[model samples]
Target: MTSDDAAQPCPMPNAHRRLMDCHAQWHRLHEVYFDPHEFRLTMNSLVQNLRNVTWLLQKQKAQLVGFDEWYLRFQQSSGSNEIMRWIVKSRNRITKEADLELLSELQVVWHQDWLQRTIGTSSKYPPRMSIREITNDVMRRYRPPFGTMTVRRRWVDKALPAWELLDATSEAYTRLEELLAEGHSAAAVPMCDLEAHDRECVTSSLRASGTRPHCMVDAKDDLEAHFDLVEGVEIESTSLVIERDEELIAKSVERYGSRAEIPTSGPIDAVPGFMANARQLMETDGEHGTFVFLYRGDALIKMGGLLFYNQNSKILAFEKLASQVKAMNADGVLVIAESWFARPTKKEEELGTVFFPARDRLDRMEALTVYAATRDGKTAGQISLVTRDASGRAICAEPDDMDDAVVNTLAPILRIWAEMDSSTN
Candidate 1:
């Protein structure tokens, strides 16, 4: 060898880097599971990153003896594994064809005891009530037990396993990690446990244990049916309405204070200012109301109102309103409304005995949702149930779709506003 060649350092293979990159993409997939647009982007990225592991390994085959033989065996094993095969096919489809098809199922289950309590034990009622009747009866109640309502959302594809999308992805990740480890071993390279890295990175509390064989990634709890209660509620059958007027808006601004100065620290710092404004609007409105506020920095530009007969209409209305708001070149748009929210059964502290999981009772309630977006396409928001008593005193429900830190910052303020007399304000 030439003296110059002897002095030069040998280049290291980047297969390990590619493997870690693939793992990072997997974690991103978990974060964007609910957002279809973001999910697609992350899913495609994960596939590409995973596929790059082998490509990188092959690229550095000259440095690793017996790489060709080891890779051939790995390919055979991957072909036999269903998830691995799907991963390969997904990468090919994403590269050459269209995006992979995804199917989603939203299941809402009500416990048996909860239904009994809601309907009452009166024999005067029929064995079954029409969807409209049930909706009307539930809405008639001054305070519905919304916290007892359980909602489970799952995404799947015909090409994928029966498991939820996250679970399936976790299984795929496990196989890939094994392949990477074995490849490294065959190449005589030192490697840390990828599973350990995954545990440290994606520490979602929703993650279930022993759901998948040799799976280190987080997996959502499986949707299970209780023998004591009915299986699922048709989300389509539910109808809800939200109405707002100038009078309510005026009252809200007067009562909740026209301007709220949000702190520039903690989780609130990460959220857009307009979202806090929207939330303040909800807190002031206090009841079933929908509001649209356009803002430029801390200043309110224009305010509008919205009316929705159902959830679907509400969503469409927001979309149209967002488009209109964007066309007006506003700095930010805040949409705040109180509507029925259904999700997986969880304890609601405010409701007390109304949401008794030990007795297998569940309830549904109205939720105040605040959403904000900027002209630059940034968005942030929060969801919570703020109920009031006969005396107009606010009772803040457990926080939803937001961390405790954000809720704790806002809840005390809501209570304070609720105590103040509107006439004085």
Candidate 2:
């Protein structure tokens, strides 16, 4: 039927009407990717190998592998190759994972809209136009960021201590920071910390993982802001290293009642900061690239260890850790990595499979600062973002709590390096 006809009420059988409705729902639904925006950006930037693989599979018999398959392969590949296609793949997988998280966000938004207009004014529930409220309304209680579950009634009282939305935000923020700090400190000594946090979550809230709460890079360091830069978008080293830092103070929990007391430090640093030497730089055109250099204490350990723990700890698993640079129809490329402060190999231990427009991109940008581990409680590892004179423009960075104007000063330094695979094709 035509558009007009489809909208018109028809004297069709009830069965026929139901079938058409179902058909229309499926046809109108967005089945491309769970998150259309991210999917589009990532997929559009697919490397040649990925593009080729995708096309080949699409043409023949190729089933897009799930997260695990792509992950193991991705971890094993070279840094350059790993960065290009593998990172995209892993992110795609995470996209699938964060579905629940995203759903939670959506539900909250819906609740606000529903409650704001009707809650207080209506004889029944009040209206709330915010997602948090909507989510709270429906779920009654959700787990905290630490991934700890909570009882609905208890969550409402504990999370909404004062029963005010403002308090809810403040509470959540404080708890989130504390949770992340605990992870960095590895302070789950009694093992009840995570469980306690879990127990505290409201039933309406989604279970939050207290172990290592998800972070949005420099979470607390933000000035209430948040990306579109394809121009000088360079792809440098994507190294995944697990190391044994001297400052690491993780005492063996096995010594429950032993004479040796548990050492003081932190839980673990999922993405801890550490400084490495600088890359070969070019004083002329500001064409600088960066890579992570391994340090003396930076021994490559398996990922599942305390310092750099991942459920799957095998180092050999990430064979795709080193990625290669492939040809692209874009502008200047860049790769910047602030690694373990230790140099792993004599010759860029893991050379990129793909070359840039210029070799200088790899040798250019050096690390300015790193997150140094420390045995001193007063000097525990910190989150630091430093910049060098790669562009001769003195780059100043304020603490994350600083104002926006102060923080935005260090906007992403867009420097283009070389082309890839020789433009002549």
TM-score of each: 0.37, 0.17
TM-score of 1: 0.37
The list of candidate 1 runs beyond 4 A from truth reads 1-13, 107-151, 192-199, 202-425
For candidate 1, write residues 151-225 as lDDT tens digits.
345557657735456656666655555655555556454333222234455321111111222122213322211
On TM-score, the leading prediction is 1
Residue lDDT tens for model 2, 1-425: 22332232221122122222322222122122234354334333322223232233233223222423433343343234312333344345545543211111121111111112111111122221232343334444432221111111111112112222111222222233232223222322211211111222211121122211122111211111100011211112123343334433234222211223212222112112221111112212233233222111223212211111221111111111211111111121112323222223334546733233221354442223222221111112222233456646423233121111111101111100122232122
Position 42, candidate 1: lDDT: 81
What overall lDDT goes with each candidate model? 0.49, 0.23
